[model samples]
Target: MPKTTETTLEINLSALTHNYSYLKSKLESNTNFLAVVKAFAYGSDSVAVAKHLEALGVDYFAVAYTSEGFVLREAGIKTPILVLHPQPTNFKTLIDHCLEPSIYSFKVLDEFISTASHCKQQDYPIHLKFNTGLNRLGFRASDCNNIVEKLKATAAVKAKSIFSHLAASEDLNEKEFTLHQISTFRAVAKNLESLIGYKPWLHMCNTSGVIHYPEAHFDMVRCGIGLYGFGNSANEDQNLNPVASLKSVISQIHKIKPNETVGYNRAFMAEGHQKTATIPIGHADGISRQYGNKQGFVFIKGLKAPIIGNVCMDMIMVDVTNIECSEGDEVIIFDGIHKASTLAESANTISYEILTAISQRVKRKFLK
Candidate 1:
């Protein structure tokens, strides 16, 4: 791999496969696995990730929007693709590409039914999302009867699966709440099954849910961040290999005397003499302004270099006074050593946000 001056997100396909295998080991032999490749596979190259997972025999792939699934389909992905949030306007495109939709509400169900009928589609597979506790998206428990009635009323669509989201699966303190959610989902699934005369695959476990609530694995499991090498907790994260490494070169170095300021808005003033290095990536590349003002740090020659000032659109300045580094030397923003979770914590966010926020402008290199 040739080195480049610009920032690059290096994706290790081998680590991705390792993560998948490790997560699969947590499930029963018969249980199915659904890989969430939404948000460009959490901002690491969706098609590449999806293709690799597909090759590894992922039972299903899910994306946040219809267009995301369409992109996968266009790339010759034959595995089943689920559109987690489907819009009424894209129903035609969804069917045209053989993509499934998660019908979470009455409006979505009604709209999809109408669209499927217009397209003359028979037994179109669609998943029903229930609001067990998250209360974000999903039909209420009361909506079960209505959902069953709607499905019985038309053969245009079929219930491919029934699922829900666990709001706090990772928090051990929220174990009771997670259990309640699992119980609620179970009851909802039973009700829908009795009404429909059959059970579609029932699933409600994300990565954290899979690790903490193995009993709630249901008929299928959805693994998102876990596949990207994070387990949501330190103990669990230890077993997974981080797949992406954000790397760049120190473009320039500056020596500032005492009382001199650095970066825009004078965000950092040298307490004494200081050495700083400017890297080629900044807010535009998804290193948010929230990471500035010394809130975040990067690794240079295996030493810490705290961010010194406001993150600019195309660059950032870091105090490298202690680190013995030079221009063109490698800088590690977040990798195995400098975990994305650590950076996210400093930025008052989560690893998911940090990973997905990495802009498309940053080139992605896949390592097989």
Candidate 2:
């Protein structure tokens, strides 16, 4: 493969397919798989990623906002898209685009009911989100009666699914808590069904939830990080291939004498003579400032180069003194060899943040 002169995010579609297959294999044949393509397909390419997954026959697609679904719909993507956080104001647009909204609260439910009715639409498929334990979104279990009342009052909207988020599905320590959440979600789903005279598709498992709680795989499973190559567990991570690789070229190299400083605010003061390589990527490109000043390292010639000084808007300097590297040499910020999970750990974050933080300004190269 030829090295690119600029920083690029390389997305491997084959690896993504492999991950999809692996995760799908974990599910029962009747269970539907929803590929979470929000946040630009976790900062890769939403159109590209969703298109490939669509081709693979994913049962559903999810995005954080309606605009994301709009992009896919415009691109001729025929898959059903679930808008996780649908604002009341975008109800009309969502309806027009054939996008389903996850109605998590009574206010949203009532508002959407009114909107759908005013639009004279009937049986518009809407998902009901219950707040079992995540508490971040979704209606409370106590709000189930009110939800049923509102839906019964309006024929404009129909419940398509009842789902909730798992707070810590990846942590073994939270196994008890996860089970409790599942139980609570099940009760909520049952209560809503009895009140409404029907049971919607019940889903509560995310990527880790699907891996750790196989029994919780209800009607469908929503997979986000796992599709882009992360399993949230050592054993599962080994089974999945990371789909994205961040690479750049060393633009310049400098030899700094003792006491010389580098980068903004002179954050890095050399103790002895040192060599550094500056790459054209920084916080603006999704490499957070927290990874600067010895906090993180990049791979050069299969060697580790610690980052030195502050990470600038478009530049980052790394200590490459011990490494046999020169300008124009390819550098790996995070790839299969230099896992994003490791880089994220150094920044006290998760791989999802690292992957999604990659800015849209950086060119994305897709490999099939």
Candidate 3:
């Protein structure tokens, strides 16, 4: 494909493969690696990421919802996909596409079983999600009795895996809490196993869990941010190579005198005479409004260019007085050299948010 007109997201398949291999090395041979490709593979092209992972022999793929799984299925991804959050309304479509749903609550379980049985489906694959301690979604430990009863009644729905989300696996200070969650999940999984007469695959660790708590890496590990190269901790962060780099070219330049105002609402007033460059990217392109008025910056010709004013829908101006760049010259938003983590720090967020928020409008180029 030709180079796009504005900004672009370059996905390095080689880095992805390396990260996968590295994470796999950290686990036991029999342990499965579930790549979380939801939100366009964390905002970097889910198809490309999933395809590369499938080729590399990833055991499974996971998404937050049923529609994301459909995208992978339609893209010719034959690997099994786990829908972390399944809605009752899309049970039919999910079953039709051979996608597995993660049933969290008793209500969810009852509804999914009812829907599947009504469709005359048998041994329909599904994952049971236990809340553990996140308190977001999933079955509470108190709901265990009801869950056991539900499982015995719903023979058509096969529980293929039991999983939970970790709330703070990266914070060493939260080690005790993390262990508590794991222990609780283990009990829940064991109880469900007893009722079902068999143990489904158990997974609880996300990227941080893979690094911080190896003992919790039971049957599988669902890696999201780690696979994309931003480990949640500093030690882990130092080890992974970021795979996605964002780049945009200068569309125009202007000289601003002292006291001059720039961008929407005149958010930035020049403190002194300065040169500014406009890049064809904005909130619509995933550069959030939080980066407006010198709060965030981008790298241009090896120098940092602070954002000048309100981030417009289609454009953002950066103070380029000190940077040696001209119109059409490329600037780095986030890359191996600049680092997505650094950009995220400037934006007062994490790399996960920045990476996942990158709009699909930006062209993606994959390089091995």
Candidate 4:
């Protein structure tokens, strides 16, 4: 990858391929793999990522909203797309785009069925999401019979898959709880199958679940963060490569005197003569305010430059008193060697939050 002339998020499809292959290596040959591309593929480029994954023979794609699935369809993605949290208002549009919805509640299910029927749809694919343990979404085990009955009575929508979200699959300490969620999902699926006389393909594992719980890799597994690189643990992270590299060039260099402060609120008072380099990336670019006042650092000339003072909307000044560098030199916020997980740790956050919080305004350059 060339040095970014501007604040840019360079996406490496080759890295993505490596991560995908690594995650897939853990699964059975027959197990389907679903790539979650929601939130702009975790603040990269969804279209580029999805197109690459589709070409790589991905089994399915998932997004948080129907509009995201529609975007994929518009991009000529032929693979099946599941709208993980679809709305009733968009049911007709979802059908128009041929996107599947994860019907989590009775209200959503009933509304989707009505919309599907109104649209004169027959056997439109839909997923049943059960609230096994992740109380965020999905139906309860007790609702299985009702769900099965609803499916039996509706020709408008067909159950393509039954799935649930794993709340703590990444934490080995919660292994018992995760196993219980899996078992509950299994019981619900079996009971639903018995009532419906057919089995919809089952899935409940997220990226962490895929890594820690092979036995719970029901019929499919959803790989989100793993697909973009961080594996939820240091040991697993070593096996994966980060796909996004946030880079910028030093916009300006400042020379400060003793007792002189930097940025708004005069946050950083120079103890002595110090050099500060301003990079054209800040909270607007997803480098949050939490990273200000020496909380975060950037790599310049292979050396660490601590961020000084408050983070501006479009700029941040970093202390470069020791590093010998010049204007136009490359600065690495995070890359394959220094992963986003590392930077995320500095701000007391997780890699997912850091990765997905990246603003869309930043230029995206892809390496295929």
- Tell me the deviation in Å of residue 136 in model 3: 0.2
Write one digit per residue (lDDT tens) for candidate 4, span 191-297: 98888887789998998998888998989999999999989999999999899999999999999999999999999999999999999999989999999998888
Better of 3 and 4 by lDDT: 4
lDDT of 2 by residue, 238-278 (tens): 99999999999999999999999999999999999999999
**Cα RMSD, model 4:** 0.9
Model 2 local distance difference test score: 0.93
- Winner of 2 and 3 under lDDT: 2
| Model 1 lDDT, residue 140, Cα | 93
lDDT of the structure predicted as candidate 3: 0.89
Counting only residues 3 or more apart in sequence or on different chains, how many pairs clash (N, Cα, C under 3 Å) in candidate 1? 0
**Lowest-sum lDDT 10-residue window in model 2:** 144-153
Q: List runs of model 4 lying over 4 Å from the truth.
A: none
Q: Which stretches of candidate 1 lie over 4 Å from their true place?
A: 1-4
Q: What is the Å distance of residue 223 in model 1 from its true position? A: 0.5
RMSD of each: 0.9, 0.8, 1.6, 0.9
lDDT of 1 at 33: 99
TM-scores for candidates 1 onward, in order: 0.98, 0.99, 0.97, 0.99
In candidate 4, how many Å is residue 101 off?
A: 0.2
Taking all chains together, the TM-score of candidate 3 against the true structure is 0.97
